[model samples]
Target: MAQPTYALIRFQEVGAAKVQTGLLVGDRVLALGEDINTLIRHWDTTEGQLDALAASVDGLTGLAVSDVEVLAPVEPVQVLQAGANYRKHVIDLAAAHRGPGEDEAEVRAKTAAMMDARAGEGTPYFFIGLPTAIASATDDLVLPAYSNSHDWELELAAVIGKEAFRVSPEEALEHVFGYTMVNDITTREYVFRKDMPEIGTDWYRAKNAPGFLPTGPLLLPAKFFGNPQDVQVTLKLNGKAMQDESTHDMIFGVAKLVSEASQIIPLRPGDLVLTGSPAGNGAHWGRLLKDGDVMEGTITGLGTQLIHCKDEEPTESGQQ
Candidate 1:
């Protein structure tokens, strides 16, 4: 059975200038306040207050979810993303970029050993993401005309509820307020910096395009999620399933990720920590995204995100 947890969301009435911080209860939304961020910033008190209001919120509601336009749940001050953190995802990439004569069996064996070693001793590869790139999950996204290899990387992000630094893995999860889904869109060709080989991967250019990180409609409270490791991440392209995997395949679990991240910087309330993506990406299947493609992503318990892709609209300069 699912836990009794309230979803945190932002919504606005048709043509209304104000976006209300809302608690999602069934098909309707109950207005909580004007700023979701403010509520998150004081989640210690907000959590208790929400508990007190749960029974009443369930019975009393303002607007039907269909009557309002849902916005991305929160604007985090920081977006820390993990790369190559999924087991099968890493194996798939290794096989795709393998040297001549590298077979799947051989690649998988080598990858298994390597990943095991990484789990025992290595730290996760973390990167920064531009908050400006985040958009509502259901919005139409324009494929940046700069690259032909736009790919999908569906992820589950941990939303921080408290200020934490240098915390232990055992204590890490205590800082997490909830979880939300995000699709980390990548321009594959730009991943490698040709001009500077030493630079290796240029994540900033390859992954931070506008609307690249399509975020939430619901923020599932941590208590409700219980164990995120069992949560499944799945993405479908044009109604055809492409990526479907679970957090069980994650190299470093959410606790390790959040704890390690805190060692580097202070994770504040409303910040997002993306725990990487699962397998079955475009590179693995040799099918990249193009204009007119649509992606629908869903995670266990979390809601779904529908996105439409189109070519970047021509500007006065005819390019972006």
Candidate 2:
């Protein structure tokens, strides 16, 4: 039998600006709170009421899931993303981009060994993402005409419940309230600056474009999806499977990412710590995003996200 799945959402009537918090149960979404942001701030006290109602959805009062328009689940104060957190993903990139005479087998072996060492004592690499980059799961992505090398990185993000500062990995999971999905879009051309190599990655230009991070239609409570480390992470382009991997491939797990990130800065309610994307990104397949291309991303237990892409239209200034 399938486990009962429930989520929290923010939705509104189609084409209306009004939005409200909703409890997404079986086939319907119950009107649950005045504001989901404020509700999640006290998740420890709120989960009991939500879990009880989710245990049984019979005779629940609300609109059907299809009747209302789902919005980005939460208005996060901060969005944090980890880079190169997948073991195989790092090895694959290394092997694929090896220097002229380097053997593929040798490159893979070196990368694998480096990853093992990092797991033992290395710190995770995290960068701040703008909340402005977020979009609804079903929203259209405006493909910037500046570069045609747009790519997708489908990842699982942990939502912060309790405030955390200098927490250990062992105690990190307790602070996670739930999970959601984020598709971290990138522009390959701006990933590494050619003009100033010392500065390293230009994340703001490579990412942070409006609608670059298409987020959740659901926020699955952590208790409901125990062991997020073993879940499947898959994404398909158009109708073909482009990225199919599991969370087991991660070099650093969610808890470590959260803990390490907290050490850098305090984590608060509604803040998101994105566990990095696994292998099989667009770079692996040699096919980048384009106009009219559709991306479908899924994480086990969490719902699928469908995003559409279109080229950005030129304005009178002739800029995109």
lDDT of each: 0.89, 0.89
Error of 2 at 126 (Å): 0.8
Q: Which residue runs of candidate 1 sit more than 4 Å off their true CA positions?
A: 1-3, 58-60, 317-320
lDDT of 2 at 111: 97
**Tens-digit lDDT track of model 1 for 95-183:** 77789887878998899899999998999999999999999989998898887999999999999988989999999999998999999
Residue pairs in collision within model 1: none
lDDT of 2 by residue, 1-320 (tens): 45567899999977778898988887788878658767888776887787777766775467888989998897889899999999999999999999999999999999999999999989999888999999999999999888999999999999998888999999999998899999999998989999999999999999999999999978888988889899998999998988788898888898889999999899998888988878888998899999999999999988989999999999989876
The clash count for each model shown is 0, 0
